[model samples]
Target: MSDYDYVIVGAGAAGCVLAYRLSQDPANRVLLIEAGGGDGHPFIHMPKGLGKILFNPRFLWPFMTEPEAVSNDTGESWARGRVLGGSSAVNGMVWVHGEAANYDRLAELAGADWSWTHIRQAYCELEGHQLGDGPARGGKGPLRISLSDYRSRLTEAMVAAGVAMGLKRAEDVNDPEDGERVGYAPRTIWRGRRQSAATAFLRPARRRPNLTIVTGVTVDRVAVENGRTTGVEGRKDGAAARYTAAKEVLLCAGTIASPAILQRSGIGPAASLRSLGIPVVRDLPAVGANLREHRGIVMQWKVDDRLSQNRDYRGVGLVRSVLRYFAQHKGPMAGGAYDMGAWFKTRPELPIPDGQLLMSPYSFDYGAPSLRVEPSGGFNICVYKLRPDSQGSILIRSRDPADPPVIHARYASDESDRASIPVLVRYARRYVAQAPLRDMVIAETRPGPEFETDAQIFEAYRRFGYGNYHACGTCRMGSDEDAVVDGALNVRGVQGLRVVDASVFPFMLAGNTQAPVMAIAWRAADIVLRESR
Candidate 1:
């Protein structure tokens, strides 16, 4: 006898979507387990309250990467949401579905089902866009996608600057036809609240009698018998608990936790498993390999105090902003992380946009212990190489489920990645020095004009560069021999087990990952349904 038809680990963006879709059929008993608690915090709903929610221990799983040569021997804090919606609840509400070409490449590696055509259709079914229905955009769906209602003169000037530099002014940043364009960013914020996966997908699913949501349960490992996952074993309320899955066990625990969970279950590299004194269930070396993240550097410029939103974030201004939010849900309190976004090629010779930029009207002191808004008026721009070839790994330190995984984010390790630092820095400088932005001119606050040469700029990046928190590819899916999961998202050497979520991505997408993760889950549900029949 089984406790559920399907057992889902982690209630993040992917897990929420899976729970909802799988439970749509009343006959399927689905159990969704989360290590974190509920998403009832007011900060989780308030769009601009990300700063408050991100560092809150109750809602976050703060994992730090091991120090590497490229990052000046300093560990970087890699935080993911520990709450119901996972990172989607704590993330900067940016909504982007990357380029169609990226999905086309996945189709090449995986199968036709993972192609752009299918993924686009899944997106159309997932979104509820405020811009209304279109051939490409969805209008009536669960996830509400909307443009940020908040605007700033500085952000408008940044878009103008991009247009003057020959970049297309995009109406929809996610539109595939808008190549090399700049525009106000689209976000997973509807009305005034953050439309996280918990809010959009799981809320409705919670009403289903067949769906069971168990939180604050720490999953130890999958209970496998004779190479087939029968269920999952974990600790709940300090007591041992086990749940069985008659159909399948789905691991949607994001990139870090999914791989860690597999390794703990003796499903990773044979050598490592032996060293950890755990009998190897499968000798899958790629279980925790190929970790990828977007590395970017921030450039801040001191602008006129009136043009920046710095004041709205501090002291009395913050109090007023709070009141305004409750009264009308309008103001900085309703804004997303970035005001504007752009995709561009560093060099004209490149066929696709190789770089991405995000602009915010407010600046933060990056070196602060926690994210602290600057007292002075300023704006910041973050520039990143859309895709880098550098790879890393995640390994378990101990068998204890409470222990955090060892993360090795080998940023800027590749020659090309290192070379792009100078190119990106120089490009950002040039972009800000153009048109109307030049008139609103100010001095570069961090890594200023003194860092003119390529070497100097590269050094500046080493000091200030940070991961964009878009980590993936640890449990990569492919048709290759060493791939952890196959084209249909099934574990290579196991039965009744699947690894969904960003962990299965063979490569990282060029933009924010939330949208793609949701789409992947939506498509995976169809695969699971077809296979179950």
Candidate 2:
């Protein structure tokens, strides 16, 4: 008398993959639920339209973090996608597989199943690269990977500058073997449209009768009975609704929502649950702990009008770009966020690149009330620590599931993270000062020439640094008893539940997280299938 053999919550990157893979078996009745509406927005498909729909609450959960000392005691907006494809539909479209060493570390913490070898094989099976298939690349998979279509003299100069600084030029930056390289970034964009997880996986699976998709449903919590998750309880169309799961309930609700959902289900820290007047099922303290994110600061330079794309984003130029995009699906309107990218070591003694830089041909005045392209000619170079040492937490604000959780993003709280800022700024200045870029001769617009000393540079970062939106490690997986999930991703204290997505990452990776989240879900589906049989 079960409604579905498997109930998958949140149709984001991980949820979409799980729904598709699990439903392949006709006997398994799968149900996928999303809190937000569909992904049919015109802006969602247009690669450059991210700036338009990113803050639109209709498509995302506009979660804001709690003010902390490190961030100058000011709360910042955190965007998490609520639509069918989730953040993948709203993200920057950067397709990075992360470093093999990071996954090798996961293998050491969890098991061999999470090793780089398996992850590489999964990438080979999951990607459809524009650059033809080979030993290291996959050309026949569902997700399409293409190089940035937008190119400019400024972007070329940026790459040349990296080469002039001794960084190796890589054909494919996604290649794990290419260490500390610079190149045009690969993206989840194909023929000018965003290749979101819903577009690649869930949409195709919709034809299957066994797969059911429900939107606008706000999941409250898992309905547990005798220490096992029987199903989920939530509100649909302003009425209470419950769905039973015959096999298991998979939580793919991302970092923020996954831990919150578990806490609501009476499965987190015992004292906190009791204080909220909720019955406790398990006393797992790590449910909403160990939050991590990449903190970054943007640097801008006022370039010559001819080399900048500022005009292309405003007035008559914008209208022309729009017309061209609708007619031919080509132009600045179809470009990804960062066209040129690089990884480098801030300190020469470091073994691998400790810092990452992303360059864009266009610049935005983020201090304004609304995000708009700068009226003047300019370009941006953003820098971030690859692996931040600071840790934070997510806790339920109240017993109500409708209330947004409190996000304590303790960014740069560690002394090392603070010290790295000056070094990173110096490295960025050096890169822009090299070769042909030096001739471009643009004055530094952000934290300009006045900020000279290390302390001044650190203060500049403190004033301008922002999260890269790659939040993870909330409900980390490990062999330790305090770990929320086991090596196979099963809830350690629950009988019929699993946490799939970036929340299960033991630590943050070295790059954008969308690609890694999808691959992890693909592997988790295999584990679920194997156990079910």
Candidate 3:
């Protein structure tokens, strides 16, 4: 058996960062286990390559949620990164901190350790912002944050439209002191290339002899002994292996696998485990509960064929697009799919923005298995409720780690969430109808102009809805009875076991998760290292 001071499972966003941070102490030997392979594929680096990687098994886990009535009995596709950088390698690459209120709420749930004042240090510690040491934004951190230089007629038009409609415009999303209003989001990109956790944090740490990265390994369960996790047991490339941790084991397998691995290790709901003939180590029912994700709808509109990038991808220009990426790294090849965004309230009384709108310069065939951007010419708007009432769960089907668990995303199950759909649509439609966006629109392409009735809108929402892929809350960290982990991020009812990924979030963040996930891991490392004293 191989042994180390700390065993971090899943080399995704948090896992990679935790390994990097913990191994800083030369005496602490850290091991990172990942089921996925390497992050060397060129598609993984290209910003616009996400459309090609969405359904590809090489980069991400192919997860399909159970049928939900809210989505019209359709199973939504869940694309989770299976690679070293985790979802950060395969995500939108947009870096958003959401609003300050979200972090304040986390403080209420976790502790003062997660409050904004203390949390700001971690934010600054991890980000290298474009605004060289602004009062609100950090200048030097492992992750390089830069603006996407790519442009499109539709992207510029959307920005113009946002200004025309009196929406809040911001140059920075991380700063609340300068009025953290929303606008076109920035990216975790550096000079036109993707900068994921793998590229930023893990890359530097990999050269450290104290840190070991074992890819193509499936972490089956936490190796628990005498109520404490000593290490982990899993198969690496079809061969069984055991690795012990001298101090503690941190679960960074993310929302889906983290809970499933917890249950497989006998730390979840006892009754549920016994049903699958797996012995229970703990009766913690909350291990896989409180599953939450944003419900989103993709609305497409037709534009003049000459105005859309769709023409660039059609025939002979496809070769040129590829060459453009290799030469300049910008053009249409550098797209992170989306270029502009807006955050606003669904109603005036709400304290925070209840809805979010993201404008992608290209539209795709939503019904297809693969994301094929419209070859002719068009763009899309993804509308999501910032805070939703809907909730669901993650449950293991059997004791086998190879069999994927069932993800009941149950999006919009709550009536409140259902009611907000129309408001979100109306808000998005109104924004597009203003200024240059309306001028560029040939017509409402998909739902068409006829879908106006409340009932009709709800139906359209169900038909077009897809998982926003921001799932969180399983194995949540809190002091409450239902919390899977306590304020210290230690798994309740167990010693020397911790969870340090998005799975531990009590509630999801308001914006894209990549930025916040890395920040959380940075703080987790501080807590784990400090408490060891």
**What is candidate 2's lDDT per residue for 359-440, written digit by digit as tens?**
9988887767998888888899989888888889998978788999999998887788888888889899999999898788
Q: Taking the tens digit of each residue's C-alpha lDDT, what string does model 1 give over 197-254? A: 9999999899999999999998999989998999999999999999999999999999
Writing each residue's lDDT as its tens digit, candidate 3 over 1-533 gives 44698999998889988998999999889999989989998888988787777768888888888887876897777889999899988998878776778878899998888877666778888889887666446789888887756566777788777777666667775666423144567787777788888998899999999999999988899988889888999998789988898889999999999999999999898999999988889889988888888888888898887777777776777789989889998777776657777777777777777778888767776666655667667888888887677779999999889898998888877888888988888877898899878988988876777889888988888887778889988988886877889888999888999998888887777557777788889989999999987
lDDT score of model 2?
Answer: 0.89
Error of 2 at 254 (Å): 0.6
Q: What is the alpha-carbon lDDT of model 1 when measured against the actual structure?
A: 0.90
Choose the strongest candidate by lDDT. 1
TM-score of each: 0.98, 0.98, 0.96
Candidate 1 off by > 4 Å: 367-370
lDDT of each: 0.90, 0.89, 0.83
Model 2, residue 520: distance off in Å is 0.8
Which regions in candidate 2 have their CA more than 4 angstroms from the true location? Answer: none
